[model samples]
Structures are given as C-alpha cells and as structure tokens.
Target: MPPRQQAQPFAKDERVLCFHHEMLYEAKILDIQPSEGSEGGYQYKVHYKGWKNTWDDWVPADRIRKFTEQNKELAAQLHAQIKHLQKSSAKVPKKGGRATGTDSARVSEERSSGAVAGSRGPRRARDYDLEQEDGFHARPSIKLPVPDHIKGILVDDWENITKNNQLVPLPHPHPVDQIINDYLEEERQNREPNSAHFDILEETMAGLKEYFEKALSRILLYRFERPQYHEIRKLWDQAGDDGPNKTACDTYGAEHLARLLVSLPELVAQTTMDQQSVARLREELVKFTTWLGKNAKNYFVSEYETPSQKYIDHARSF
Candidate 1:
C-alpha cells in the first residue's frame, strides 16, 4: 500500500473535527500528548465546543483532522439554526420574572447533575491533591471534591449575585462613618434648626457609604479564588519568615493563613469558583479583615492586586 497522508500538527485551541462513534464532531484541541511507543505519533485531548464537557474526549491522531474554512462556515450556520430554534421554542417569562422553559430547565439540570454529555471512563480531580485517596485512585465515576458551601457557587451563583438584592449589606459602624458623623455634628451645632437643611446631605452620605461598602465587599469575593492567589501562596511559603511574604503576613497578623486563603480560591475555583464564588470571597475577606482590624484588612486586600494583576497581564501577553 502507498504511504498514508500525515496528520497536520494542531496547537491547543485550534478548531478540528474529531471522529467519535461514526460521526465527525466539531472540537477544539485542549492538549497534544506525544506518543511513546514503537510507532511514534501523537494523541489529542479535545473539548467538543457545542456539546459541553460530556462530549470531551481523547482520541488518536488518526481520529482528528484540522477544521477547514468550509467546516467553519458550516458550524456557524448550525449555531445560528440552534439559536433560532431555541428562541422559537422557549417559554416566555411571566410578569417581571425570568424566562423559564426547556432550555433554561436543561441548563439547570446539567449544572445540578454535573453530568457531561457523552463522558466516559474515569474523571480526574480538579485539584490534584496527591495525598488524598480520591486523588490517587482514577475511578471512571469519581468527581472533584467540592465543598458543600461552594457547590452552588461553581454553577448557579453567578446568576444569583447579579441581582439587585444578591449581596447582603455589611453592618455599619461603617468604614467612612466617622467623617460623615463629624460633618453632620458640625452642621447641627451651626444652628439648632439646621438639621432639616442637612438631612438630605446626611442621607446621601449614608447611602453612598452603604452602596460603596456593599460593592467593595462583593468585588473582593469575586476575585478571592482567582488563579493569582496560587502563585502568591507558593512564593510566600518558600520565602520563610523574613521575606515580603512574612512581612505582609506578620503585619496583618494572619501569618501563613493569609497565603492559604489566597491559594484556597485557586483550588476551589477550579471546581467551584464562579461569579458567586468571587462575591462570597470578597464578603468573607471583608469580614475576615474587619476582625483583623480596619487598617490591617485594608492593607491585606490592597496587597493582593499587584500580584494578581501581574499574573493576569502576563498570561494575556502569551
């Protein structure tokens, strides 16, 4: 027989058509693993973009081909058709509430079940904690360990936190209250009957503070589990007691706990971190820092940004 055509080298995220069951499905290459046997070649781990995680799989190079311009155009047409079908079939929302129907219900079901579409064999833990038994055994049905508190966060929490009533207001002795009170007191002493004129001012100040604090707290929560936390923890731990990490930790009185909290989100986010996770992380950080003292809390949250932004910018450059 004549020589077979060589498979084209595809990079991660390149579009491709993978043969599964007897059909070709659109997928994106997630990883390329090199072959080690007598017949050297490669295999690909691909994510089926249209079918959700259930359809993700690993296949031999023979099973995949680079997606062409024709394939791209066809895929776009299919996507348009799907969206049209969904709009026509979806149930409209009642009154002021959200739309509910088969599509929405299916999404909710998929989230709760955490079931992948055509998933097979064993699943790997999101955070590979080798010391744990679940991490050691590669069971086909095994799931990443998600904390009870965060399961909802990893899925539906994003929708919940976006609503107007999502974040609860933190109790006031509010951070900026002293200045507001001082202004109000000065107005009151200026004239006994001046209270009425200054009432609006006080109310405005109070409202601004409430909203600011609420947003700030929620913002912190959203960023809590960002990947940057992982890098920070690793560096901080290796620096011992006299470096920047120790100084920051000792200054905040949180010691290594600070590093852990920062890193905790990285692991959790892999399994459960979403918009809701970020919101909750911020709220919790605010609460944690408040307990640590106002000045210390301010310092801790401020320090997180430099490293986090640095990591994000660096990743984007690549």
Candidate 2:
C-alpha cells in the first residue's frame, strides 16, 4: 500500500518566513499543492515580501516557517550574519592596485563554506541555467561599488518611469551592445592580443550581452515598463524577426543595463558555480561596472521622454 499523504502545515495566503540560502525572508503563501515526490508532503507558492512578482516561486515545506516573533528574530540574526559575511569578503587585499586572483578566491571560498555550514537546510541543485533563472536563492556574498552619481541616476530612472510616467526613448543613442563593445575595445588596446586577460574580457562581455538580453524581459524591468516591453515585442514580431537575434541589448541603453548590474547579486546567488568561479565573475563585473560609471554621461540620456497621452491610454487599456 502507498504511504499516506502528510497533512499540510501552511495554507493559502498565510504569511511565513521562507529560507533562501542562509537567510530568511518574509513571504506570503499564494497557493498550495500536494507534492508529487515519494515523500508525501506539500509545497507552497510564495511571494517574497517587497520583491517583484517574478521572484514568487514554489518551495517545499522544509524551507518555510511560521511568521512569529521568534522567527522574526531569527530572520534578523541571519540578516546580520549575511551582512557580516559580505563585509568580510569585501576586504580582500589589493596587489599592484587590483585584488589578486588568489586572495579573492580564498576569501570567496571561506565565505561560501561558512554559508553552507550555517544554512538552515540542505542546498538543492537547481536544474536551470543560472543566466536565465529567477527567484530568491543564495546570492554570492559580494558587493559591487556603484558610484554615488550612478546611484543618483538609478533614483532618477525609477522616478521618471513610475512617478513621472516618462519613458526612455527607444533606439537609444548608446545601446547596451555598443557600450559593451566600446569597453571591450578600450580593454583590448591595453592588453596583448592573445593574452589570458584579453580572452577572459572577450568571453565576459559576450556573456554580459547574452545575460542582458535574457534578463531584461524577465527581471530587469519594473511593472511600469511592461507596456513598453510589449510594444518592443510587437515591433520585433511585426518585423518578422523574433528570436535570439532580436533582443533588448540592441535597443535599450545603459540605464536598463545598470538595473541589470544592480540585480546581479540576486541572480548570481542562484548559480551552482564554485567559489573561485563566482569570485572571478565578480571581479569582471566590478571592472565593467566601474567603467560604466565613468562613461555614464555619454551612455545615459540627459532626460527621459514623456510618453504621449495616446500611448499612456493604450498602455492603461492593457
């Protein structure tokens, strides 16, 4: 005879704390379903509080706990631990004005090991591409140094779209792909043609292009930008070129790309890469983001354009 089904502990719309990596986030249970696994438990669809809808996902019972004062205290403790780890990792010593690959790798390894050992549950290997996946997970505990001016740009970008009802003009003068290529060209001029640094730079830029294209429609845009996204999709469809070749990278500019950079920590946390690989990727990302900040004036538009009344009406109709 089959094993009896286990009773469900959570109900739909219930508020709870769900574990993602070593941290606990407040979440609301959206739906519940019986587990199909040999173990006869249930799964819950959770919407993480304050996160985008794209981050909502189904999690097993083991990853969730009741939302009580105790759990809240636990969550705060975990958050503090995470912050401490990030601070520790960020202190890698510099060699010749740049972090030595060895030191960075060692720091990342220590951090990763500590997180795993201290986590509340076993880390599951996800069967999805890190580049394309979404939802909360263990983020590689590293921080990117975005400049103060660039932070101001992010604030303005948010205000323009969600508050002012403005839109970034399409076919931006400096598209994401162009900005990446320009950075690559600048790097190549200083490095040997066939050197390891140049090769990694090329591969990293290529990955960034692909990642920007995939992540834009998935997690990069806010709800206010959905109408613009659909419009872009319609144009691409009408042109009879819909596929990998037609992508946001060729149309969106540095503003959107900056959004992607800011979101990278969450995205990178979902990957199954080893500490060293994660560290290396972090280094490359830091270099590119720093370059992007320097060229912000040239790449980012001075002002966002206000959408036409007709366009706004059409968007609202959707």
Candidate 3:
C-alpha cells in the first residue's frame, strides 16, 4: 500500500503517516522501484506503525495515502479495502497454469524485450572537456592548455607582482600576455570578466583618456591664463572658507574679500559664544536671512550652510 502525506514528518521509504487514526494511517508512496528479483515494485519502510514495527509492500507511486475530509472511521474502511485487495490477488491462477496462459505469454514478451535491451551493452561516457563547453555570455574562454607552460616572465614595468604576500591590489594583465609569458598565469586564468569587471575596465580606460586630455588642455589654456588664474583663485577661496590666506586679483575681488574679512570675526566669535549669545545670534540671523539656517547654525553657519548628510545618517542610526 502507498504511504499517506500529512502535516507529519516524512522520511524516505517510510511513506505512511497516521493522523486520521492509530490503526488507519496514510500511505503516501516514497518510491516505486523494483524489488530484489523480478517479482514487482518495492515499497520501502519509510516510517513504522500498525500490526507490526513496519510492513513492506511493493506498490506504485500513484498510490499515495491522503486524509482529505477523512476521519478515523473512513481511514479504517480504506485500510480494510487495501487488505482485501492483497488477499484477493492470491486467489488468481498460477502464472504457467492453462487458465493463466495469456497472462504468462505477456510476461514472457516483456522479459524478452528487457533482455535484448540489456544485451546492447554499456559504452564509456566522454569526459567533460573544458574546450567543448561554451564560454559564459559569448566571452572569450580562458585558454590554459598547460599549467607549467606559464611560470615566470614580466610584462609591464609599472606592474607590481606579489611575493607570497600582496597587500595592495594589482591590475589584471592581458590574458594572452600573462599566459604566454608565464607570469601571474594562474591568477589570469582565474580572473572572470563580469559586469563589475567591465565597469572597472571602463573606469581604467577613462583615467587613461583623461591623462591625454589634460595634457592637451594645458597647451591650449595659454591665452586665458590670467582669467583662468582668477577663476582658480575663486574656487580655492570657496574651498578654503574665504579666509585671509586666500588671494584675489579681479574686479570686485577687493569688496568681496573685505566682506569675507569682516565676517571672519563673527565666525571666530561663534566658538566663544555662551548659550545666551548663541540664542541672540540665532534670533538676529533668523531675522536677517528670514531663516535661522539650521539648529547648529549659530556655532558654525557661514562656513557650512547646512549640517552634513553624515550627521543625518548618524542621527537616524540612533
């Protein structure tokens, strides 16, 4: 009989489950394999219960036990029906008996077909060849015909090769160059090119391209040297908090520099302000700008117009 499936633990072979009743259990089949000789299918002892420790019966996979809308009484009736089925099969005529000749002939034909199928014999399976397999996404496959062919040969002069220890990251050399030259060959073979690897490739190419662009730009920038100087100073001043050390040499540069110098004292005074002074400044600044800027403005506003996102992330974490 097949094993039953329930909300119970299921193991291999012991397919029966008992939830509907103690005597009547579920027989959800675990397997439908042939038994020891050529008699029929095999039912393994997956779980144990009822009549003995366990009972083995060779049954088909379609014969799984279930308990949908079933209870103790229905379960017992199902079990009785299965037991009757087993006994009724024994009353059939012997396989070679005159009355069972038709059944006997069918069994012989099946056995004869199976014997020819076996006599065809087994052949050796081919080994998994790396070259035969397609590379992922049509990428060039790593060609490593010989491991010992590559051992030691330098390529790029700027490249750093590790000696049993590599704390710094190094760039991947052209695969053929490494493989043919016998340098970083093992690592070259292991390196796989994916989306991230392609991104890194693009970034590296961009950096190399930028080197040439800047070299050309400096040659063409000779005409606007003074104006470019002023622009650069402005950017420097903005970066340096418009301080005394920052230089200015263009129109309205003096006036802007004066305003910056005047504001310097207020910025310095902020560090010394008591709570009362801070409150007063916060109020005055709010009235002047129509906004106090931020809660941390009084102490450090003119330098930083707003608190950094780092502070927001830290506050959010808390």
- Compared to the true structure, candidate 1 yields what TM-score? 0.22
lDDT of 1 by residue, 1-318 (tens): 433333446678888976442224678999887665655557789987556577577787655655875435433433343344345535565686863522233334434444221223223332122233222122221111222323323223334322221321221122244433444564455322523224534554454344333322122233322233344446657887755433221222222222223333333344433443233233223223223332333322212112345544553342
Q: By summed lDDT, which 10 consecutive residues of candidate 3 come out lowest?
A: 149-158
- Using Cα atoms with residue i matched to residue i, what is each candidate's TM-score against the true structure? 0.22, 0.56, 0.15
- In terms of TM-score, the best-performing candidate is 2
Which 10 consecutive positions of candidate 1 have the poorest summed lDDT? 136-145
For candidate 2, write residues 1-318 as lDDT tens digits: 665687677889999998664357889999998888676778899998876677778888767877977558556654554455456655766666654322233234334434210223322251222222222233454345566688888877877876788888887788998899899888687545754446777887898888888777666665556688888888777766655325688889998898778767656777677654554565567768877887889999998888888878775654
Against the true structure, whose lDDT is highest?
A: 2
Clashing pairs in 3: 2-27, 3-27, 3-28, 4-26, 4-27, 4-28, 13-46, 14-46, 14-47, 27-65
**Candidate numbers sorted by lDDT from highest down:** 2, 1, 3
TM-score of 3: 0.15
Write down the lDDT of every candidate, Cα atoms only.
0.40, 0.69, 0.29
**Candidate 2: regions farther than 4 A off:** 1-141, 241-245
TM-score of 2: 0.56
